[model samples]
Target: MLVRIITGIIGITAAAFVIQTGGVVFAGFTLLLMLLAWFEYVRAFSERGMGIALVTGFIALAAMWYAAWQKPELLALACPLIVLVMLLESVLMRGSTSIMDALASGAGLIYIGFPFTCLLQLRGMLPETVFSTEISSFTFGCAFVWIMFIGTWASDTFAYFTGTAIGRHKLCPSISPNKTIEGFMGSVIGTTAVVAGLGYYLNLPLQEMAVLGLLIAIFATLGDLVESVAKRYVGIKDSGNIIPGHGGVWDRFDSVLFTAPLVFYFVQFVNLLGK
Candidate 1:
């Protein structure tokens, strides 16, 4: 508990600073997290003798990142190429690497990398991106980011307390035994409440922000569960031990992975509808 509290404080503080920055710097922060998460991801498999191509994995990430930064259109092209490269590497060295290894490695480069890219796109880092009309306003990006992070935080905090107090049934005993149905309820309701409360002040539509919060809570839970399942498959307790209590960047920021994309698309769709 002590370790968790300490880590939470430091993490929240750092995240606040980065999100507040809201530009290429914030994108860099997101990229750093993705890179760390990706490294831990591939390392987990490699340790299990998966023989993942580490150099190629990083090169793929770099290429994809460059595309997102320099040529957003090339992003689509880079993604499939990443998977193809990994598969080809495995095929050429079948004795060392397996087809499954290539698939997993390739997916990681996208799964971990793409969300961060979404975050970048969400923050309007790329040209002619996000908030269709408010091109120069970081408010559009920062406010949405606030929605995702705060909603996810509310979900985790409320779920922990709510679960401990009244949780009776396991939510997903197979993947994450500690999760409870009561906790899920708390997360969704609590996150929605918090987001609706703040969203109004942020100039977002209250009804829509409430819905976004609910969706964030749901997707955040799914993200955490997915990461848990991945770790279980890798036969590891946590992705890595970068955090004293939390585990790795993935274990810490897993909730944001899905929610970032969720918020980006939700906002864009909302904007389109408003038009």
Candidate 2:
């Protein structure tokens, strides 16, 4: 428990620093995480004899992210191009790499690459001019990203304690035996309270923040469960031993990966509605 608490604090501190940095530094941080996540991902799936080409995978991953960052319009082309590249490689290798294995490699690119790129999008997305009069667009963008991070982290943290204390009924016993219905409720309530408070304090839209908080809790739980299922299937306890008492980059960012896209589009929808 102590180790978990200490790790959480350290992690949060580092996260705060980079979030505030919010430029090339944050981009570099996100790239480093995506690379670590890719490493863990390939290593985990290797158990099933999926021999993903590491060099090709990295190139495709970097290309996809570049499209997302600099050329949003090119993403449609980039995705299919990646799949085509994977398929070609698999065909060339014939007996060495199955088509299923090739598809899984593409799936990993989408699963890890797209969501990680959304973090950049959310951080860089500027708000409407009306709202920007009060708060700088840069500051507002940073706050939105903060809400995403905090909402997911709070949901996961409270769920654990709440489940341990008053958990009776199982939520998903097969995927994660420790999860409980009570804990799920706790996550929803706790995430709402914390995020609403943050939203109000930040002069953000309280109503939207409240709704986003609920969405984050729901999706964050689902995200954790999805990763848990993958790990269970892969016969691994943790994704990697990178982060002490917390598993790995994949484990730490799983909930954020799920919530990042949610918060990004939610805020954009809000901007549209306001306009």
Top-lDDT structure, candidate number: 2
What is the per-residue lDDT of model 1 for residues 92-143, given as tens digits with 9 covering 90 to 100? 9888788988888888887888887777777663334333223234356676
Rate residue 95 of model 1 by lDDT: 86
- Residue-level lDDT tens digits of model 2 in 210-235: 88888899999988998898899889
Clashing pairs in 2: none
Work out the TM-score per prediction: 0.90, 0.91
Clashing residue pairs found in predicted model 1: none
RMSD of 2: 2.7
Candidate 1: Cα lDDT at 163: 94
Worst 10 residues of 1 by lDDT: 126-135
> What CA root-mean-square deviation does each model show from the true structure?
3.6, 2.7
Q: Pairing residues by index, what is the TM-score of model 2?
A: 0.91
Model 1: CA > 4 A from native: 125-138, 272-275
